[model samples]
Target: MSAPTGKALEEVRAKAQADVRALRKRVDHLDNDAIDLILRQARSHYAWTDKPVTDEIIHELYEITAGGPTSMNTCPARFVFVRSQEGKERLAKSLKPANVPKVMGAPVSVIIAHDLNFWTELPFLFPHEDRRPHFEGKAEHAEVTAFRNGTLQGGYFMIAARALGLDVGPISGFSNEIADAEFFAGTSLKSNFLCNIGYADETALFQKLPRFAFDQVCSFA
Candidate 1:
């Protein structure tokens, strides 16, 4: 694809600028239904319908999630989508009893992981400068950054799925060691968490739980 130029570039920039202005106004915001679909009405779905989540949808989900920002664009998040029966069985071995059925029943279980040596790609991802050397000997700092950003990316994945009309049940009830051995063996990647993705069974949800109010959770410097 040729790079957009002239009128196309101007149109793109103009649309982006208009979007920013609209966001600043906060008046032409997402409709209530859209907000609900992405956040409010969304739930951590444990039970799923029989509808299969296709590869195309998974690809689209990754495309959307990949757009989320990361520090120095490290983007260490790695996903292993377990959709086959054998994959589910392997994942089940790592899950707690209560979470096994959830994983097995969902259309797909995503193993969200991060590469411990993510900084090795800093030269490519953040190529404007030589940044890879900074993390070469800093194992502790690199691991921390990878895990933190990987977890954040997983959150973005869940939101992206929700935005695409899919339900997600993210859980930490699985054995990371087992997951790593089964799915990421001989690799630098380490499992962060598991997320079941599919259409939800509304009847399977429990009453919504309460959340801390904004006033109770925020403070000014």
Candidate 2:
């Protein structure tokens, strides 16, 4: 009910600093350049070996990702891991030609989805007050809010995965309609993106790409 106390704040600060220190070693250095490289290299990977991704590892990633903020703490994002032959086949059929092969070849692909009826469950997630009534008559607003927040959560998932020494290949070139029907059938969750998770082959990457300077993208005024 109340804001964080002084001790709570100190504890949070200590934990965050400790996390940064640990991540520094895991990420090769806790610098902006290292972060940029992590983001840049976490692109769509096409070639994969026959290694398997364990559910325990995925659960670990999920636990880390649960810390990402969402609007009203609604946390509307949902993920469906497609590991079975039938599930992968269904997911593969929905990818674009350029993405299909990579998705099919990856050890595991996760479908990041947003639930249309997520607000209805907010009573449990946002327990301070019943926020479901606020969204009851605002279908359009709810959809946009859920999509935007869930997308943010998905980005955090990728960053957390990278921090955990896993390579990510997130793609949007999949058929929403088909994927929804095939993989998300009987569910209110709608496909937002697909990401292949595994180790990266350093030899498989092409030349590095250029990026805009900070001045070009940001302004002090």
Candidate 3:
């Protein structure tokens, strides 16, 4: 990778700025090399190399992902890092047989969960007023919204990991009820998804899948 010249940097920035303007939005102008690498190939990675993912990278991923928006700033998303062999073992028991080997071999496994009672903390997280009152009588509503948005945050977590030079293999082919029992016992948090993180094995990549074009999947109306 060559260093970007000042003129080249300015040209890319100006083009991005114009694109955002045409799209009627203002995006953060952070110049991140990992972001460039991630945008080049954002697909899910299956096989992984022996290279390990560091704790520092995971911390940075969370720091960046938390900047994404959440409803009422509720930020109900919670992440459980499964790094040790034992920790991975516990989660592996809940995995479908097909996923067991993939997850166990990864450098890190993440349990992305949503707190069913996250609104309880709204008084502090959204402290302008007693925002808890707004969520009090709407228990079911809170759960639904939290699950939806928390799932979105999990997606952001994957992208952030990819943006920080890690590849992700996110999976939902597990027993959620069993996962909750094993990992989050006695907690209001419910497991939404699990993802494996590590350096990708390029040789293991499948042929790139096709995607629908804009007109095939969207409407101007």
> Which has the greatest TM-score?
1
Q: Which lDDT value does model 1 have at 66?
A: 95
Scored against the true structure, residue 13 in model 3 reaches a CA lDDT of 78
RMSD of each: 4.0, 4.5, 9.6
The residue-by-residue lDDT of candidate 3 on 1-221, one tens digit each, is: 24346898789879989887976655555456655666644768778888877878888999998988888889999999998999989999899999998888888889999998999988667655567876788989888978998998998898888777788989999999999999999988999999988998877777778888889999976
Estimate, for each residue in 1-221, the C-alpha lDDT of model 2 and write its tens digit.
33356888689779989998998778764677567656854464667767778888999999999899999988889988887778888888888888877787788888999998899877677765777887888989888988999899899988988888788888888898999998678987888998888876666778767879988999885
TM-score of each: 0.88, 0.82, 0.82
lDDT of 1 at 175: 96
The positional error of residue 147 in candidate 2, measured at the CA in angstroms, is: 0.4
Candidate 1 per-residue C-alpha lDDT over 151-170 given as tens digits, one digit per residue, 9 for 90 to 100: 99999999999999999999
lDDT-sorted candidate list, best first:
1, 3, 2
Q: What 10-residue stretch in candidate 2 is worst by lDDT?
A: 37-46
Where is model 3 poorest over a 10-residue stretch in terms of lDDT? 26-35
Q: Flag the better candidate by TM-score, 1 or 2.
A: 1
Best by lDDT: 1
RMSD in angstroms between candidate 2 and the native structure over all alpha carbons: 4.5
